[model samples]
Target: MSSLKFYNEEGAGQQNSDLYHYSQAVVLGDIVKCSGQGGWDPTGKLDANDVEGQVDLAFQNVNRVLQAAGLRGWEDVYSVRSYHVDMDASFEFVVDRFKKHCPDHRPIWTCIGVTRLGLPEMLIEIEVEAYAKKA
Candidate 1:
C-alpha cells in the first residue's frame, strides 16, 4: 500500500495551514487531491473583487497547489468541483474559465451554488482531483 504524501505551499505552514489547519493538497500514489482554494493570496487576503477576477486567481491557486504536489499542470486534472455564492451570476464565468484553462484536456466538473463559503468576501472556491502515473 502506498502512503499519503502531503504538500503545503511556503508560508502556508505558519500562515494559512497553521491558522486553518489544512494542507493545500495531498497525494497518494498516482492520485492527487487538493483542498478547495479561494481567490485569496498566500497571505489569505482576497485578491480579486469581482467574480471573473476571483475565478482567475482561484485557478492559479489550484495550479500552484498541483505543482507543489509534483504535477505539471491542469492537464493532469481529471475532476473539478467549485462552490459559488451566486450560481446565476457565476455559472457562465466559471464554465468559460474552465474551458480557457483546460482547453485541450477537460476535467469532469461539478459546480454548486452555496449560501456562503468559509469567507464572506470569497466569491468562489475550487477543488480538484488529478492523476499522474509513476515515472
Candidate 2:
C-alpha cells in the first residue's frame, strides 16, 4: 500500500491554507493529485485581472504544484478539472491553454460552471490528477 504524502504550498499557499487547511497537492507512490489553483501568485495576490490573464496564471500555479510533487511536466497529467465563473467565456480559453501546455499528450478534461470560487475575484480554478501510468 502506498502511504499518503502531503505537499503544502510553501509561501502564500501556506498563508492561504491558514484560513482553510489543505495541501497544494499530495503524493501516493507514482500518483500526484493537485488541488484547485487560482490566479493568485506566491504573494497571495491576484496576479491576473482578466479571464485570459487568470487562466494563464492558474496553469502556472498548477504546474508549480506538479513540479513540487516531483513530476517533470504536463505529460504526466492524466486528467484535468476546471471551475469557471462564466463557462461561456472561460471555456474556450481553458481549452486553448490546455492544448498549449499539454501539446504532446491529450488528457481527459472536464469543465464546470460555478456560482463562485474560493476567492471572489477568481475567474477560474484548475485541478489535476497525474500518474506514471503512461502507455
Candidate 3:
C-alpha cells in the first residue's frame, strides 16, 4: 500500500498555520480523508455568530481543502460529518446550505450535537471523506 501525503497550505489552504502535524488531505491509495473544517475565514478566524453564516463558512473551508487535493466540490465527497453546537439552528442551516450547494449528489452525512469545539466562538465544524477515481 502507498503512504498518505498531508498538506499544510497555511492561509492558502484556509488553515491558520502551514505546519499541520499531519496532512490536510491524506491520500491513501484511492481514498482521501479531509480534516474537520469550521466556520473560520481565510485568516483562521470564525466569521459569524449565527448558524447560517457559520455553516456557509464551513462549506467554504471544505471547498478549499478539496480543491487543494485536486478534486471538485461536494460531488467528490463520499461521506460527511457535521458537528454543531446548536442542533435546531445549525442543523437547519446545514441542511438548507447542503441543499443549495449539493443539490443532486447527496452524499452520506451525519450531524452531531457537541458541547464545544476547538474554539469557543465556533458554532459548527464539518469533515469529509472522498474517493478518487481509478487512474
Candidate 4:
C-alpha cells in the first residue's frame, strides 16, 4: 500500500500553502494531483488584461508542482482541469495554450466556467495530474 504524501516546493509554492492551508500537490501510489493554479506571477502579480499570458502562466504553475516531484514535466501529465471566469472570452487563449504545451498529444481535459476564482484579477486556473510510474 502506498502512503499519501503532500508536495510543496520552495518560494511561491510554499508561500501559497502556508497562506491557503493546502498543499501544492498530493501524491498517492503513482499519481500526483496538483491544486488549481491561478495566473499570478511568482511575485503575486496578476495582469487582468492579458488573457493568453494568464492562461499560459497558469499552466506554468501547474508544471512547477509536477516538476517538484522529479516527474517528466507536462509530458507525464495525463489529465487536466481548467477553471475560467469567462469561457467565451478565454476560449481561444486556452486552446492556444494547449496547442503550445501539448503539441505532440492531447490529454484528458475539462474546462469549466465559474463566476469567480481565488483572486479577483485571476481569470484562469489550471489543475493537472501526472503519473509517477513508481513501483
Candidate 5:
C-alpha cells in the first residue's frame, strides 16, 4: 500500500500553514489535494486592493504547490473550488485567470462567496484536486 505524501512548498500557500497545522498539498496514490491559497505573495504579505492581481497570484500559488509535488499540471486538475469575497464583481477576473491557467481543458469548477477569508484583506482563495496515472 502507498503511504500518504504531504508537500509544503517553501513560501507557498498560506503563511500560517505551520500555525494552522496544514500542508500546502497532500498526495496519496495518484491523487493530489491542495489547500486553499489566498493572494498572499511569496513573502506572505497580502496583495491588497487588486482583485485581478489577487486572482492571478492565487492561481500561481496553487500551481506552485502542485509543482512542488511533481504531479501533473492544470490539465490533470479534476476539480477546483474558488472562494471570492464578492462574486458579483470578482467572478469575471476569476474566470479569466482560470482560463489562462487551464486553456485547453475546462475542469469542474465551484465558486463560492464569503464575507471574509483567512485574512481581512484577502480577496480570493483557490483550491485544486488533480489525478495522475502515477505519482
Candidate 6:
C-alpha cells in the first residue's frame, strides 16, 4: 500500500491548529479521496454566497486537488457528494455546472439539503472520489 498525502491549500490546517486529522486530499494507491471543499479561496475568505458562485468555487477546489494528484479531469471522478443549504435554489445551478464540467461521463452523485454547514455564509460544499491507473 502506498502512503497517503494531504494538502491544506487555504491554510486551514494552520489556522485551526488542533485540526490535525483533516486533509484536502488523500492518495491511497491509485485512488484519491478529496475532502469536502466550500466556496472559499486560498486566503480562506468566502468568495461568494450565491449558488452559482459557490458551486463554481467548490468545483475549482476539487479540480485543484485532482490536478495535484495528476489526474486528467472529472472523468476520473467515480463519486461526488454535494451538500446544499438550499436545495431548491441551488439544484439547477449545481446540475448545470456539473454538466459543463463533466459532460462526457456521469459519476455517482448525491445532493443533500442540510440546515447548516461548517460555515454560516457557505451555501454549498462538494466532496469527490477519484481513481486513476497506477503509474
Question: Which prediction has the highest lDDT against the true structure?
Answer: 4
* Candidate 1 per-residue lDDT over residues 1-135, each given as its tens digit: 247888876653226677878788889778999889887766667843588778877888888888888998688999999999978877888888878889898899898889989878889999999996688
Q: Compute the lDDT of residue 103 as modeled in candidate 1.
A: 88
Note the Cα lDDT for every prediction shown: 0.82, 0.83, 0.78, 0.84, 0.84, 0.77
Q: For candidate 2, lDDT tens digit of each residue in 4-118?
A: 8877657666677677887888887788999999888778788435898888888988887787777875878999999999888788999899889999989999888999998
The TM-score values for the models, in the order shown, are: 0.90, 0.88, 0.87, 0.91, 0.91, 0.84
Poorest 10 consecutive residues by lDDT, candidate 3: 12-21
- Estimate, for each residue in 1-135, the C-alpha lDDT of model 5 and write its tens digit: 248888877874545677687889888778899889888788877867888888888888888888888865677788999999988768998888878888898999999999999889899999999985662
TM-score sort, best first: 4, 5, 1, 2, 3, 6
lDDT of 3 at 12: 32
List runs of model 3 lying over 4 Å from the truth: 9-20
Per-candidate alpha-carbon RMSD to the true structure:
2.1, 2.5, 2.2, 1.9, 2.0, 2.7
- The regions of model 1 sitting more than 4 angstroms off are 11-14
Cα-based RMSD of candidate 1 = 2.1
Residue 7 CA error for candidate 4 (Å)?
A: 1.2
Candidate 4 residue pairs in clash (backbone atoms < 3 Å): none
- The deviation in Å at residue 123 for candidate 6 is 0.6
Question: Residue 8 of candidate 3: its Cα lDDT?
Answer: 49
**In model 6, where do residues sit more than 4 Å from their true spots?**
10-21
* C-alpha positional error of residue 99 in candidate 5 after TM-score superposition, expressed in Å: 1.6
The runs of at least 3 residues in candidate 4 whose Cα sits more than 4 Å from the true structure, single-residue gaps closed, are none
Error of 2 at 10 (Å): 3.1
